[model samples]
Target: MNKHIVIVGGGYVGMYTALRLQRKLGKELRNRSVRITVIDPNSYMTYQPFLPEAAAGNLSPRHVVAPLRRVLPKATILNGMVTKVDHANKKVTFVPGEGEPREIPYDLIVMAAGSISRTLPIPGLTDIGIGFKTVGEAIALRNRVLHQLDVAESTDDVEVRRRALTFVVVGAGFAGVEALAELEDMAKDSTRYYRNIKPSDVRWVLVEATNRVLPEVGPEMGKWTLEQLRERGIEVKLDTRLESATGGHVVLSDGTEFDAETLVWTAGVKPSPVVTEGDLPLDERGRIKTTTQLTVAGTKDAFAAGDLAGVPDVTNPGQYCAPNAQHAVRQAKVLGDNIVRTLHGQQLVEYRHKYVGSVAGLGLHQGVANVYGVKLRGLAAWFMHRTYHLSRVPTLNRKVRVVADWTLALFFKRETVSLGEMEHPRDEFRAAVASNRR
Candidate 1:
């Protein structure tokens, strides 16, 4: 019997796991012994860590994502969402981009659906706030910041100018910090082209409910990061929460209120809500429960990893592995091999590895890193940050393209052009039709 495997989600875990299986089960896959399928809403696997650089125009957004068809030619790529997963029936209801939903049967299932931006019920947040998790959001933010500068420069209204120049980012985690730092730096540099704006006029505020930034990098580095941002004139408001952002009126829990044209929400992420339909055992956090071996606990022919999987940490008892790209990429290797081993009746190997620490870019020519018990800061950390992520960008094609982008940066200025119309390509056509009628 041919063993068919369906992998859901085409992000880090899904792409890498299928790549491993493509390499390990090449013979089985070719001879009809095994089949692989990957399903995702987007056709590409985004390297999320570089999103800040992409947004800052330091790296092209295209280089940070690997197209699913180009990366995994051997596997069946489904460009759509998985609407339902009935493990008992060995089928999942797949919905394509422009078609009705249909069921797909498989001998085994791998849930790598990943996560979504965790949001709050804060007033007007949904209307004004944007999350920084996708390539689209990153580029949109770049354009949005630059457009705000344009608005501020061309306006005479004090309130309009103030709101346009003020940018607020909530959350001080790696995502929020890097985003704030990179965008702030980019916007400051962008002031050279504007006649009325100075770098000082642009107010960048970072609000975090926690007391420090980059908690993953340790308290000392976090403290240092705070000092550095303050030195750059970035308002790092710790122990403060965003109470409301109605109509771009940002109201902080500390009894402060301000109007800002841009609000980026990067507080945290929760598992993709699609997992709720899978009928699998989920932890309190709504992640699929999995063993260290990467198999869904107490279930056969089922597996999970990445942000959506609750895999227990062997090194730290009573704790689950952190849902970061570090663990997701590593766990993918074990998952692919274990699936192959199960088919061959071999003993499954455990997925165990101590975390290697973290590195974060604080914008151009600046960064902080904690790796293997060693701390690095400033330009050295920045270089390490680029080198580390450059190595992990996936595929030689993408790596070379990313390196080329960095190399080009050394000789040329960063592109600050804003193409906001990309979001609404039909707006001009609608206006043309209205003019024709007039």
Candidate 2:
């Protein structure tokens, strides 16, 4: 019987691991010695770093994601969720779209389900706030922002216009900052096309509970970022918490209240709840507890990595690896190599990499980066951000397409058109069919 390897989640870890296995275990796979399978709800792996650019219309949403079938042809791809993992019995329950759950047995399992946006129990938050995690969310946000502009321009009511124009983004990390900066820039640029709307009329607010903005970057860069946002007419409220957002009425802990039509929540992320469903050992933060080798602690023939795994950080003692793309990508490589070694009765190597630095794109031709104790800002940093992420985006096809996009962007005007109808595409068809039947 062939040894089966089942991988959960098609994000960074799942895609890279499957790719590595295909390349490294080609002989084993062809000889029926081993087989690999990947399961994910989406058929594509989204390069989350480019979500801000996608939302700002710098790159097409389709280009930022890699289709699993195209990228990992050697591995069996399942478009579904791993609802349950019976590791003790070497069986996994998967639920595909429009079908009942089914079970499959595996010799080994790789848990890399990734993380989801962390949310709170605040009233009306679920109804109003949108996250900036997936490509769908990015596209939706772009359309929503443009729709808000349409509402502001077409309405004559002063209060309604104010609410429509006010955009609130809760979080000061890279996602929050980049999404706010890019969308704000796009909105500012879009003002020229509207006779009733001006750049000054739009209110962009960044509400961070922490004292600093970009904590990943040093304090100096964080302060500079705060100043830059302030200069760009963005309201930066630090050391303030969101009290409630009931009925689109925002109340902050600082005795402030306001009604806003748009609210983006990019605060943070927690490990996917699927991790808890299994019998794997987990840390206090609900991440799979793993050793330096990326193997699930206290488990046999099981491994975990990426945002869901709490792999010990050797470079930073007493801490686990940060949930970032850089670490996740590097960890996947090591995990794949180690898995192969273990199968061949060879020794395993620990996963360790020193902290490089941080980078953030503020807006068009503006950014901040700190690498190896050297700080860079403005156009230089922006170029560096694009170059670094572009190189890490995965697949030669995607790389070429992204570069093509940037090259064409220099010559053509930025596209501000929103295709929100794509989300509910079947609605029109269903309505037409219903009318015909009537």
Candidate 3:
């Protein structure tokens, strides 16, 4: 019987691991001795770092995602979710697109289901706040922000205009900071097109529970980021929490209350609930418990990585690996190699890598970075930010397209057109037919 290697989640781990396997085990794959299958809800893997640029209309959404089918031609790609893992019986229960659930037996399993946005139970959050995770959310946020500008420009009522112009973003992490900076820059540039809407009419606010922003970049850089944001007229409230957002009215813990049409939530993320559905051993945070070699604890034929796995950080000693693209990509390589070694009955290597640094884009031609204990800011850091991510964004085709976008942007102006109507394309047609019948 041929060996079946099943990989869950087609994000960085699933895609990269399969890619490495196909390369390393070319002979086994060609002889049909070992088969690989990958299951994921999305057909393409989203490069999450570029989401802020996509939200700001800086990069095309299509170019930021790499289709798994094209990238993993040899591996079987199943567009679905792994609902249950019966690891004891070596079977996995999966739900295909609009189909009945089925059980798949595998000789080896790789769990990398990734994670989802970690939200709070704040009032009206579910209805009003938008997350900055998927590409769809990024596109929706861009349209929503632009639409608010339109509403503010057309409305003469003071209260309505104020609400339309005020935009509040919860959290001061990388996602929130980048999203706020990029959108604010776009809105500032867009004001020239609206005669009645000046740049001063816009109100941008950043709320962080902690005393600083971008904690990954160290305290000095965090303080510098705060200064940069405040210099641009954005209100930065530290050690503040969002009490509630009932009816798009924001109430902060610092006794600040305001009405805003836009509320962006980028607090953090939690492991995918799929982790707990299985018989796998999980840490306190509901992440799969794994050895330093990327193999799940107490399991001989199972492996896990990425945001959903609690892999120890050898460099940090007492801490688990930070859930970031940098670690995910590197861990995937090690996990892939370890799987191959296990097949050949070889010793597995431990995962150990020192922390490098952090880089962030702060709108067009502006950024902040701290690499290898050296700090950088302004245009140089911005260029470094783009250069680094461009090298790490997967395929060459996507890299070229992204570069093309940046190239064209140099000659032309930033596009601020909103296609919010695309969200409900059939509404107009439905209304037209009803009117004609009447």
Candidate 4:
């Protein structure tokens, strides 16, 4: 009988784990006979850090994601969502697109399905709030922002113009801050082409519920970031919450009411809900409870990592590993090695990594960084942000393309064209049919 390994999700953890396992167990396990399979809805892994830049036209969106099939040629990549995990039966059930649910048995399982955006039941949010997690969402937002400008320029109605020119972003973490900065930068640059619109005509607001923004870099740096964003004409409303956003009308808890056609939701993320279907022990936050070795607690032959796993941070006793790319990448390596070690009857290694600080891009030629106890701001921090993420982006092919995009940007202007029609391709046809009937 051959041993089979099934890895779920093709994000950082899943992709890296499969890659490491293939390399480690290749020649050594030829006679032993082992097979590896990876399951994910999409066959590509998105480099999330560059998503904001992609949305802002700083980097090509295509370059921010790597095809999983190309990266894991040795592993069987299946396009599907694992719906259920039957730990007792040693089989997992998955439902691929438009197909009946299927089941497969495996000797070892690695649960790496990452997280989904945490959402609240806010009015109109479900209909209007745009997510900033995946490549598709980022590109959609870019098109939307550009389209809004077009609407603002062409409209004669003041109300329509005001709504179109107003942009609201929630949250102030890396995702929110980078997205706010990049889009604001793009919108400001794009205003040059809109005869009726200027940078001042656009209302850019960043609402953070916390007392400060960019808290990942610490308090002092966060305060500095607040000043930088405010100086750029973005209204920073801290200690505020969005009460409602209905029909383009925004009602903030801080007694602010406005209308904006663009509403971005980058608040935070919760672990993937798939883990709850299984009988595995989970933390209070719905993440898989894992030992420091990255193995599922009280379960043999089961492992978990990435945003979905609550692996204790051995370096920071009471805290679990933060759900960030840095921790996920490093944890994936340890998780893969431990899996191989477990199979070979070797000692399992515990995951322990120190905090390396944080870096964020405020816009082109602007950023903030706190690495190794040293804080950098302005152009230097911005440069550090690009340099760090560029090196971290997986695959040589993607790295080259991203670099080329930046190099080209130095000599050329950012692309300002918006393809809003992409969102509703059938609108014109529907209108044409209705007119003929009339």
Candidate 5:
């Protein structure tokens, strides 16, 4: 029987794993003796760092994701869900093309199902809040923010205008900070075009449950970030929780009330629910338990890594590698090599990496970074943020395109048009017909 390697998710781990494996096992990949298959709902791996830029209309959304089929031509790419995994039986149940789920046997399996947004139970969160996860959400947010300005400017009602102009962002992590900063900056610029709206007329709030924002950076850098945001007129409410957000009327735990048409949720993420669907050993946080070599504990043919794996950071001793693109990219390489080593009967190397510090984008030419004990802020940090992620992004083609986007952005005005209605176009058509009938 031919040896088959089936990777679950086509995010960082799945794409890179198949890419490296095809390269390392060049002849083996085509010999029919070894085959690699990747299954994912989407065909592209999103460069999540650039999502804020895409949301701000600084970069096109299409440029931020690399197509899985084009990147890994040698590997069989399946656009479907890996619903069930029977590792003990060496087969996985999948539903392809809305058909009934069926089992596919494999000699080895790499479980790299990533994470989804971790939302709270706060009232009206699901109805009012927008998630900043995928490209569609990013674009929708951009549209909503810009369109809200239009709504506010055209409206005569003070209450409606106030509600439309207020934007609330939950969480202060990289996603929350970047999204808030970029969207705020865009909205600020966009206000110049609105007759009744000024930047001051808009309210931007960053609601963080913790004392410090951007805790991924140390306390000092985090403090610096908080101050910078406040200086720019963004309300940084630390140690505050959102009590409710019904009908776009947000009530804070600290006795604050606000009406906002826009609510962006970027709190954090937990492991994908797919992880729990399997019989794999999982950590307390629902991440798959794995050895330092990125292989599943006590399972020879089973392996896992990326955001879904509890990969221990040997340097940190007690801590697992944080679910960031930095670790995911590096871990994927090690995982691919380890898989090949295991197949070739060669020695498998343990995965041990240290922190390279953190970097974050804060609108146009603003950013923060704490890289290699060196702290950077403002334009320098922003440049570092772009330069580093550009290099870390999967392919050379993507790197070139992102760099080009940055270069071109210098000579042009940031686009701030909202396309929110694109998400549900039929609503407007239905409303128009109803008005005609009346």
Candidate 6:
């Protein structure tokens, strides 16, 4: 049988699962007996854990993403979105980067569409609130932060300076804390070049609706992390909600008000809404329901394992595995093996791995980690954070480039210039045209 398998995403699961299958089914693939096609909006798999470094100029944005075509040489890669999956018909409506949507048939499917940033309806948020989910957002925030500094330096108005220097980040999860910390580090380092702007002038604030940050590391570590943040002159507002941000004017649940030119929303994430567009069974959380063995519940030739799939945690009874990269990476291994097992008429292996704890970097040479009940803080944890992720980032090319970035950082200060034109390359050209016409 010329088996065609279409993977609905090229993220952590979709990419890794395809990689594993390519290894296990080499003969079958070479014989033209098995085929794999991976679809995604971008032609790459972004290693999100490195996004903070990318934003802070510690690593290049391109280094954090693995081009799908380069990594999956044996598989078909489509740059597009899967609008709908009619599993009953064994087909999915595929929309390319451009052009009309068309239905593609497949004998098997892997749902790994992943999650998206979960944002609330806060005023002025649509205009001012920036997200911290993608590499592009990271680059944009970096540029905007640096550009704000230039505006502050050029103007003598205290109010304008205050607005430009004040930065607010919502959500105290790993993303929020890391992003605020890394950007603050970059901004403070950038002050040496500005004769007027000092590191003391910049205000970094973190708001969390929940009472704690880094909950994945447990309460004690969470408390320690909070303490570390506060010690760095970073404001940590717990149990505080963002009431509004109209016109860059932030109003918090605790009645705190400020004009922050930069407001980053890293609040949380929900499973990709595309999950609802498919016929797969989903749990109450709107994630595809799958067995511990990584197969979709009550379905054959259909599989899912990622942030969008509700995989059971056999290690912890009555609980589903958390939506995280740690679990997603490991699940992909089992997911690929199970698919191969199914094709070979072998028994499917169940996925059951205990939680390995968590890690987060707080700027340079600072971090916190809780691994196997061993709590580490300061530089030790920072090293662990880098070591763990370096091993996790796909491909030797990316790993080498990341290491090169870190090596160069040791010998030189970060490049602090803001290329604001990256956001609008044609603005200057348009202005030139208007001038010529006049």
Model 2, 1-438: lDDT tens digits are 468999999999999998888889999999979999999999999999999999999999889999999999889999988888888998899999868899989998999999999998888897679999999999999999998898898999999999999999999999999999999999999999999999999999899999999999899999999999999999999999888898899999898899998899999999988898878888988899899998999988899999999989999899889999999999889989988987888899999999899999998899999988989999999999999998899999999999999889899989877677888989999999999999
Per-residue alpha-carbon lDDT of model 1 for 1-438, expressed as tens digits? 589999999999999999999999999989988999999999999999999999999999899999999999999999999988899889999999998999999999999999999998899997678999999999999999999999999999999999999999999999999999999999999999999999999999999998999999988888999999999999999999999999999999899899998999999999998789877888888899899899998888999999999999999999999989999999999999999898898999988979999999999999999999889899999999999998898999999999999999999999988889999999999999999999
Best by TM-score: 1
**Model 5 clash number:** 0
Model 4 over residues 52-167: C-alpha lDDT tens digits? 99999989988999999899877888898898899888889988877788898999999999999998888988656899999989999999999989888888999999989889
Worst 10 residues of 4 by lDDT: 26-35
- Between the candidate structures 1 and 6, which one is better when assessed by TM-score? 1
How badly does each model clash, as a count of residue pairs?
0, 0, 0, 0, 0, 0
**C-alpha local distance difference test of each model:** 0.94, 0.92, 0.93, 0.92, 0.89, 0.93
Error of 4 at 317 (Å): 0.6
Instruction: Identify the runs in model 5 with alpha carbons over 4 angstroms from their true place.
Output: 426-438
lDDT of 5 by residue, 1-438 (tens): 369999999998888888889899888877878999898999899988889999998888989999998999888988888888889899998888677888989999999888899988899886679999899899989998898888998889999999888999999999999999999999998988888888899899999999999987788889999999998999999999889998888999899998888899998898888888877888887899998999998787999998889998988888889998888888989999999998988999999787889999999899999999999999999999988888878888888888788788889887777777788989999999999999
Candidate 1 or 5, higher lDDT? 1
**Which residue pairs in candidate 2 have backbone atoms (N, alpha carbon, C) closer than 3 angstroms, thus clashing?**
none
Off by over 4 Å in 2: 427-438
Tell me the tens digit of each residue's lDDT in model 6 across 348-414: 9999888888999999999999999999999999999999999999999999999999999999989
Screening candidate 6 with a backbone cut-off below 3 angstroms (N, C-alpha, C), the clashing residue pairs are none
As a whole number from 0 to 100, the lDDT of residue 350 in candidate 2 is: 99
Q: Write down the lDDT that model 3 would get.
A: 0.93
TM-score of each: 0.99, 0.98, 0.98, 0.97, 0.96, 0.98
